[model samples]
Target: MTTVRIPAGWPATEEQARAVQDELRERVVTDEPGPPPRTGQVTGVDVAYDDERDVVVAAAVVLDAADLTVVAEATAVGTVSFPYVPGLLAFREIPTVLAALDALPCRPGLVVCDGYGLAHPRRFGLASHLGVLTGLPTIGVAKNPFTFTYDDPGIPRGSVSPLRADADEVGRALRTREGVKPVFVSVGHRVTLDNACAHALALTPEYRLPETTRRADALCRRALREATA
Candidate 1:
């Protein structure tokens, strides 16, 4: 596990964080199709927090896209860098997540964040922020739709419905398993919305959540427990 420290100029107020987002959001690439699904490696990133202890733990797990086998994993623990703020949660987690990704032994081809991307109210979420910083193809596979509205997808696996913010189709509600609740997917950077949903389905061959997310979530929680112990 790596230990992380908040950068010297890290934002301390919501205004400052929003200003940073405003600047970075313009750099997020949307035209690129990114890597094809089921090729190269895909990584999942998640963070666990111990608010009372002011500790955050982040985990990154890379899997072979073809078979979903784990290729590499890394964890990082850091001080909570920012207070909880709606739509700005990425600021609290990104430092530790970047550290965990940096500690990984293999290249993370496509990063999947257990959060939002273009589906965000600001249209820039954790996945999008990470992608812009690393210049990696990334996507978000979220458990909930946040504030977005979407019609329920069909009962069958692989069905999808547009996740809408007013009139704009920001993402998709993708059914990964028959009769299971769908996962919300959105383009982060260097990937299209369609390909993002395709990759979500490919990673979720056996469950409602992708193997990459399941693994990283568990690892981050474990790392948090160890850090607080």
Candidate 2:
């Protein structure tokens, strides 16, 4: 595990954080189709928080895209970097996440965040922020739609419904397993919404959530327990 410290000049208020988001949001690349599914590496990143202790633990697990086998993994623990502001939650988690990613032994390739991307109210969520900062192809696979509205996807696996904010199609509600609740997928940086959903399906051969998310969630929670203990 790596230890992380909040950088000097990190956002100190919601206004500052939003300002940072507005600036960085313009840099998020949405045109390019990212790496093809089932090729290269796909990394899942997640964070676990102990609010009472002010500790946050983040994990990054890289899997071989073709076979979904683990390739490399790393964890980082640090103080929570920001207050819990709804749309600005990225500020609380990014420092340790970046540290965990930096600690990885190999390139992360396409990153999948267990949170939002363009589906956010500000249209810049954790995945988008991380992608702009790292210049990596990134996507978000979220369990819930946040404040967005979406029609239920079809009951069959691989079906999708558009996740909408007003009239804009911001993401997709993707059914990765038949009869299971769909996961929300969105473009973060260089990836398209379609490819993001495809990647989500490719990563979820046996569950509603992607393997990257499932593995990283478990790892981060485990690291948090060990850190607190």
State TM-scores per candidate: 0.98, 0.99
Q: After superposition, how far is residue 8 of candidate 2 from its true place, in Å?
A: 0.7
Model 2 Cα lDDT, one tens digit per residue, 117-168: 9999989999999999999999999999999999999999999999999999
Q: Which sections of candidate 2 miss by over 4 Å?
A: none
Cα lDDT for residue 216, candidate 2: 98
lDDT of each candidate versus the true structure? 0.94, 0.95
User: What's the count of clashing pairs in each model shown?
Assistant: 0, 0
Kindly state the number of residue pairs that clash in model 1. Answer: 0
Writing each residue's lDDT as its tens digit, candidate 1 over 2-28 gives 899999999999999999999999999
